[model samples]
Target: MMKTAVIYATKTKHSKKLAQAIGLFLDITVQNITENPVLDDVDLLFIVGGIYGGASMPELLAYIKTLEAPMPKYAALVTSCASGSQKQIAVCNILEEKGIKVLDEFVCKGRILFVSATHPNAKDLKAATDFAQKIVAGGLK
Candidate 1:
């Protein structure tokens, strides 16, 4: 079996839900980055998080930096954001700098818990899950 790790940072659980969906599809272990994950035995790593303001959570960056494994063949990034911004690119850049090959990047509309009026609903969740399925099926490559 292909070893996969799904690490995510989520404040209100939107990102965590998406990560779980991806994990279900890939049959991998899912973890929260805040809990301190060890990536040594993972063959494929999927980093998932949310974009706050215009960037990803600092903890996610820190976790990425702490990773000690050699670049994996498939590294995927998933983010829950209000819209498609540079956050995904920033994540891709960081992973690339670490010599990790990024295979796909996925983003979906997320609810802003602070600003409850602009939150994503069930439709958005479905869209995100569909995107995750595509990534797992190699459609995002």
Candidate 2:
């Protein structure tokens, strides 16, 4: 029974919504990255955010830097332009640099500006919840 904390930064609310879905599935509360979340007592942490300018939101990365050394067990979640391939890589590199074991990653669809619209909708939220459930059930193995 791991105590998990979800920290996310979202501009358009898509990432926040995904974090909420995951938090709801895990029975945990979702905290915004701007709120300066702590993970001392948490067994698992979910770093979630939206991609911007071909990378993750600056606020999210900045928050991650404020964490103490020997970072806790964690995973990455993102609502990005594509499938979050680039964002995941960037995040994983940062986490791994701190010797943190990144268990897994989850990516949900997001609406791009004036490009592909209608994302992070009902279906996306459902998928996010389903992904969270599976991740929780598997214990990040």
Candidate 3:
């Protein structure tokens, strides 16, 4: 079996929820990067998080810098204010700099956590899950 790991940072659980859905589809483990940073054992790594103020989370960036895993297949998922914008492109560039080969990138609209009373409703959740399936099927790559 192809071993896969979903490593992510989540503030309001939207990204985490998406990761979990992906993990279920791929039969892989879901790890929160804040609680864990070591990913040496994972064969395929899926980095999931949100784009905040045009960049990835600081903690996620730090973790990526410290990673020493063999150049495994890598992919990224993000909840963003605008999909496929400069922020997403920046994230892809950063991952490439870390020597992680980005296979595909997926993005979904996310409501500003503190500024919005409501966010990531059911429809958004479904979109995330569907995207996860696509990644697992190698359709995104």
The candidate with the higher lDDT, 1 or 3, is 1
CA deviation > 4 Å runs, candidate 3: 82-86, 113-118, 139-141
Tens-place lDDT digits, model 3, residues 1-141: 555677888776778877777777667778898886566655567777877778788887777776764645566555544342434565567678877677766677666645433556666667766776666677423
My TM-score estimates for the predictions, one after another, are: 0.80, 0.87, 0.77
User: Which candidate wins on lDDT?
Assistant: 1
State each model's CA lDDT, in order.
0.73, 0.73, 0.67
lDDT, residue 111, candidate 2: 79
| lDDT tens digits, residue span 1-141, model 1 | 556788899877888888887777666768998889877656667888888878888788877777675545567887788664435667788888887788777676776645434545666556666766665666322
Clashes of each: 0, 0, 0
Q: What is the lDDT of residue 18 in candidate 3?
A: 73
Model 2 gets an lDDT of 0.73
In angstroms, the error of model 3 at 127 is 2.0
What ranges in model 1 sit over 4 Å off?
84-86, 113-120, 139-141
What lDDT tens digits, residue by residue, belong to model 2 across residues 1-141? 577788888888888888887888778889998789878756677777777777877777777777795457666554545443445566777777776677777676687765547777788878877877776677754
C-alpha RMSD in Å of predicted model 1 compared with the true structure: 2.8
